[model samples]
Target: MEQDNRTAYFYLFGDNEDFGMKSCWIRNLTKAPEEIEVKLMEKGIPPMLTKEFCKFPEGQESLNKKNLEIVWMEEGDGAALLENGEILCVIPSWGGDRGFCGYARDCNGQGGFAWELSEDNEIRKRINNAISFIKEWNEEVNPFQSLQPQILDYYEDIFGESEKYYAIDNSDWPPKGLYVYEGTEKIVFATVAVSLRPQPKVEMYYEDASKVNRIELGIILKSGLTNDEINNIASLISGITAIPWDYITFVAEGHTVEFETIASEKFKYAVLTNKLKLLPEMNVPAFGNSHTNFLWIVPVSDKEWKMMKESGSKVILDKLDTIGEEIFSLERQEVV
Candidate 1:
């Protein structure tokens, strides 16, 4: 087995940029000096003084007496450098800002992907374990390659010509949702729930159902979306996932169904839970029914839910329509 041959580089910031310093490829922190000297010669400190400065108790006391400060570098912020000097992964400091901590990877120069740390205890523990694994990884072994190659290959294919893919770890913020973006526009917004106890099962649903569906319209109204509009929505979803799969599933009557309808059936739960709200005047008899021209799901936070309740259904529906059009326009421009 060949080793990864990658080195992790750590950095420390001083009181000013002039004193900021970086460490050599750090494989073991315990064996390295705690405080690294920076700009010692440039600061006019003699070579003899530099040698004495590293000489332990007296050196530390002498430096303190001269009002010189020694800054220690830790594993808080670092990057994995490839053998050829290309950066592999960006590592964030532990116990730092929750929003700022996560792993970022470059995908063969096609694009990149980032997974932000969620507040879930299990998820956070997994991230911590990942960091520890990177630190403890011996360069002489190939057992753990840090990241799965299949996952990287999958991202390379999905990103296509796009510049980047950003995914939020949904273990906490949105509960079970995972929202991914291409550039600045949202491409995939899905919520997935998994059951791991007796048997493993996955339930996934899109956040915006209408944008991912195609339907034959029997009646057209001023508020109804055109076929072109519906197609654009489907295109956006396809572009984000880069996977060729049917966004819509039609179940014929008398057919034994093992899976429930994602569009009509499960989406109602999003509404019931205040994650989505439908318009009363849409004239759709029931969600996922044959008569419905389009099925749309809107995500609302607790604060937005309260506001929607007070604003009445008509106002909420209008607001949602406006937002949907804006998002559609953005996606369309990106596609073009």
Candidate 2:
């Protein structure tokens, strides 16, 4: 037999209705769709979509049906069973080219939206899956439609009506909207779309990775700060939301970020914390999977950051509390 190097590598993230979102490489299924031949298996398929198969698993991921077993055909080709546990008859994808792509099955909507994008009006005959799964998405098939509203609702439920909701579509349609909630003494700003995907090495953060794999960042500001200060905070929150995806790492409690020679030079660094003194009710998880953890960004000075690294964020928190230092204020006194 000749060497067949074609292999579809995939990684599953976030389960919805027992269906998972998957990312794959080896071929771009969106630009070129291919179906695999059916093959009956004597046994069931193992969990193929894992972090092990997808090291440094970056983008190229999307929604996928979960727990369905697969049967492999000759020459690196495979077939995924539908919810009914039957294989759909399909053509041989490995014949023409010896490469891989995203996984999809005609039944149960195994593949995410990207595979569906390729099944345009012209190639309807070649594809068997229905596009009904994308009803929540916009006409352009935006995936964030279903996820963003949950965060919006969460903020509204806890913080009441936002005086001004600032969102940008530059990166994603709901590019981490900063919901501005006004209070008599303090102001709150919570980000909306940061948890659309899981973080890298999130498993190390908690035993239940699903519960802690995702996060939403927030910062409460003291009342009477200048408009420019508030806007600077908004810009900072929006930028921080992209850090995980942009850097492929997870931000959790105790994580600290230092600002460069940026505009908001009042506070040089920040520490991630969950102890929201203003809105005690806002510290809960915001999603069905319990994946949305809220981390408050408490800014610190250079000396304070050095002290925090030496003693820890908890000690810093205690030191700040002892001095009656207001953590929500950008112009607050340094505790170092």
Candidate 3:
């Protein structure tokens, strides 16, 4: 048997950032293909990726409907099952050449306005809601409507000639400040950074048995400076910034390090949402936006945890009521 090389199946939800005011139309891209088949031997059906498949141990009986599994050992050809028992195999065809692409009818009454652009980042937060609304309206859309001319007209206005070097088309109307990279299997959609300035650099570190990469931010005042003078400086910084002084610590380490304040976890969110406008890795696991710096706190063994608490180095401090071990961050701006 000739070997086939294809990636395992992965589901797509569609892209919103690529389309603008009509961004709501993004959700129509999620429906399964009318006919999906793998090439080569052409008879073996693919499996479904359900919750059971992700949970069950790997093997053949694990290939049951409850644990729909697809193996990548053979590459190229793969299969998948629809909820209603329809089997979609890997086959060769024009549409199958570049994987799959299908048109969906707009079921909504808003003049096929299944997808619409949102006012702000509100759409990103309510993506699931948007998908549900569009699915309900897909049945009404006319997939056969001639959109090529309209798409051409939109691009001609921007690039003077819509044939090539154009930014967008009718098939995929990306929103401003969004990028879309569609693949044969999965699609990746991301919101581009809005800042004219370049993105900042970030470094990550995980502590093991002997060393600590986390640094504590401490502010120092001159020895001659009165307590009132120190307090005034502290108040000024706190007011201008979201960093809380209570979260900060004052340590007199000779003249080199005078006053220190531990930056809080809340400031992390504020910096990313208001300043950067991009997601960071550490906070990606959580749904909300990320701050200027990305930091994840992994707990050490209980023995180390107790020793650190008594070390008096102020290695671990809790500002956001983060009960277990904690992590803090600092921003790294480009030098222009």
Candidate 4:
């Protein structure tokens, strides 16, 4: 579909002289590197590498690197060759404040999309991935959706087949949903497709590298909980997985969130962690060049929450190690 340039304001009009650019979000738009360069050159805007994201644009470090390909978008960020053999470019902006990421066809582009030619095949791959991500988002498609079956297979291999699955379709925000694996001793409430789409801008809130990787949330409990309790657990995990998209941010290890209601009265806050202690080691399945991680949601008391906010998830986890690993016990005592 042809897009009206008006979709983008603060654009380079028929002629411009400010020597600056502005951007608007885009949908179903793409231009070849040379085409972008020629368009800019027609206006005498050389596609030179004027702005270098030495650290990569503000949010580049944590974007869906796998999808946006932030890693291969390296320094000495190359230029998009223009009609004059150059194109002005700002490298690696998809991981920026905006959810869209790719080559900003308009120079004044999607929040900040970027791409240029590079001899290095790795950089080429990164640029290609970024372009693909933006296109997918614009067309309202998720390339990761194909990973669902693979995700299910992974869970079954590690956690055993689920007794039941809830929210199996994308009627809600996230296509991924919750799975219940009933065991002789305990029931595992885990998310399967949550990891299919990596959480947005995770590095901004977390120093731990693991948070950036795709992750699935899990909650384990002793068997024999009432059906009402089972439903509550399933609903909670399903919602928690969508928190990143819900809040337009991310939740990582060492992060804590208070809930008005949860599975128990003693716990009002959830302390998320990946450094498991009592639960069995969950080996995640590899997808393409990467692997997903499993993060367990451990319920905590107000006092424990305070300690976690003060020190980190470590303090709370260590205490659990000493006091007890009762994360599954809905009626357990407060650790603090």
Query: What lDDT score belongs to each candidate, Candidate 1 first?
Result: 0.26, 0.52, 0.23, 0.53
Model 2 TM-score on a 0 to 1 scale: 0.56
Candidate 3 ranges beyond 4 A from true positions = 1-30, 34-213, 236-336
User: Lowest-scoring 10 consecutive residues by lDDT in candidate 4?
Assistant: 73-82
Candidates 2 and 3, the one with greater lDDT: 2
> What is the total number of backbone clashes in candidate 3?
45
Question: Which window of 10 residues has the lowest lDDT sum in candidate 3?
Answer: 194-203
Q: Any runs in candidate 2 off by more than 4 Å, and if so which? A: 1-143, 146-150, 173-175, 259-266, 276-285, 323-325
Candidate 3 lDDT score at position 74: 12
lDDT-based ranking: 4, 2, 1, 3
Model 1 lDDT, residue 278, Cα: 25
| Model 3: how far residue 224 lies from native, Å | 3.0
lDDT of 2 at 178: 68
Sliding window of 10 residues with minimal summed lDDT for model 2: 88-97
Q: Report the candidate with higher TM-score, 1 versus 4.
A: 4
**Per-residue lDDT over 59-106 for candidate 3, one digit per residue giving the tens place of the 0 to 100 score:** 112122443332211111121222223222211111122223211112
Name the candidate that leads on lDDT: 4
Write down the TM-score for model 1.
0.23
* Residue 310 error, candidate 1, Å: 18
Q: Give all TM-scores, in the order shown.
A: 0.23, 0.56, 0.15, 0.61
Model 2, position 286: C-alpha lDDT score: 45
